[model samples]
Target: MFDSEIRYIISSGQRKKPICQNIVLLQQWLLEQGRCVVCGSFLTKGEKKPFGTGLKIICSCNQVYFYLPLANLYKRLSQNLYKL
Candidate 1:
């Protein structure tokens, strides 16, 4: 179910457009899996963390993943540009 959705999103025009919605869907599916895709430890949403110019999610096994809304990513990048 989730795999098909993910595949559809990937094979579609998702990347060319904003990806937040698709990313959220993928995240939900990953969480529903109930285990880390990496070390296989039980997966839990960690405290908000950073990933490049976006926010990320961390698992119990310390695997970090890119997980930010498109709006947030744009806002974050704009803010960082101002800091320079």
Candidate 2:
């Protein structure tokens, strides 16, 4: 099993900002899901936006996540492992 820690930085326009941390658990749970947790778009990194950029995951809870090129949904699932 592969495990990695992920960190995200958000700008609040001011000097103060918020930081979020998460762990990426590479396991079969994600592999068997076979669908985007945010959107059921077949979870392919090849998917692109109309503007010719990579597609992003927009959750119903208003959370925005991005998947790296050629990455699968498993990579994006790491975001859900965050503890706020």
Model 1 global lDDT (CA atoms, 0 to 1): 0.49
The CA lDDT at 21 in model 2 is: 22
> Model 1, 5-74: lDDT tens per residue?
6455453545432356666655555545644555655434554556666565556655654444564221
lDDT by residue (tens digit), candidate 2, 1-84: 222212333345544322332112222344345444444434444333321133454444433444544654334424553322
Worst 10 residues of 1 by lDDT: 73-82
Q: How many times do residue backbones clash in model 1?
A: 0
Question: Would you list the clashing residue pairs of candidate 1?
Answer: none
RMSD to true structure for each model, in Å: 11.1, 14.8
lDDT of 1 at 19: 58
TM-score of each: 0.31, 0.26
